[model samples]
Target: MNFSITRLEDWQQVVDKILPQLQHPILLLKGNLGAGKTTFTQFLLKNLGSTDEVNSPTYSIVNEYTSPKGKIFHFDLYRLKDLDEVYDIGIEEYIDNAYLCIIEWPEVYEEELYGMKFHTMNIINSETAREISFE
Candidate 1:
């Protein structure tokens, strides 16, 4: 699925359509800085029945949230230098235990998920709006 949004409220529409289509626990978000990755997540978690505040996990690496379904672990792997750094942070254990894992800047660890099933959402931010592609 793909979407183009000019306003923040538009995120809800995108979230509504994608929520039902979310079959896997792992969701890889790809986009440049300030491209609304975290904004998208905030909407997603709200629709998923979460009451916790959502923020970028850039420095913390991971943030946890709760929902009627189960636990959600949101990760930001942009700061990590390599796979070793990813393993040192216990990325595998988090994914193993999470009900859902939303990873932003997942390039470093993406290959590690070779045969696993996961969803990918890419956002392209332009001067006027943001374009999103989900699969």
Candidate 2:
């Protein structure tokens, strides 16, 4: 799916459309700094029935939240320098246990996902709007 929107509330429309299409546990979010990746996540978690406050996991690396559906682990791999750093965090264990994992800046760890089934979304920020491509 592809979407282009200028307002933040439009994220809910994107989330509502993608929510049912999400059949995998891992969702790789690719975007540049200031893109709406975390913004999209907030809408997603809210639509998933989560009441917990949502925030970007940039510094913490990972943040945990609960929803009626199950546990959700949000990850930000932007600061990780290597795959070893990714492994050190026990990403596999988290993915194995959580119902869903929304990973922002997934480029660093995506190679480890070979042979794994997961969803991918890319957000491109343009002068006028945010463009999203999802699969």
Candidate 3:
């Protein structure tokens, strides 16, 4: 499915629409800088009952949040130089935990992620709106 968000408030509708289809534990977010990946993530976390602050894991690599359902691991692989760095940080361990794993810049480790089952969302941004397509 695809959705268009022309305002920040539209994020809630997108979140609501996608929440029911979250059969997989992993979510792979694809987009360019300023494409609202983090913004969409924050909305998702909030809708999941997370009261804590949600921010990009750009420097930290991963950020963990607690929701009413369980733990959520948000990962940003943008800074990793290679797949070795992902292993160094124990990404496999987290991926095996059966919790929600929201990943940004997953293209960085595309080969490693090939076997994993995840909900992929590609966000395309225009001058006044953002288009999100789920696959």
Best by lDDT: 1
**Residue-by-residue lDDT tens digits, candidate 1, 92-132:** 99999988999999999999998999999999999899999
Superposition error at 54 for model 3 (Å): 0.4
Model 2 lDDT, residue 96, Cα: 94
Best-to-worst order by lDDT is 1, 2, 3
lDDT of 3 by residue, 8-119 (tens): 9999899999999998988999999989889999999999999989999999999999999888999999989888888998988887874699999988677877677789
Give Cα distance to truth, residue 90, candidate 1, Å: 0.8
Where in model 2 is the C-alpha error above 4 Å? none
lDDT for each residue of candidate 2 in 6-54, tens digit (9 for 90 to 100): 9988998999899999999999999999998898999999999999999
The count of backbone overlaps in candidate 1 is 0
- Error of model 1, residue 41, in angstroms: 0.5
- 1 against 3, candidate with superior lDDT: 1
Off by over 4 Å in 1: none
Per-model CA lDDT versus the true structure: 0.96, 0.95, 0.90
- Tell me which of candidates 1 and 3 scores higher on TM-score: 1
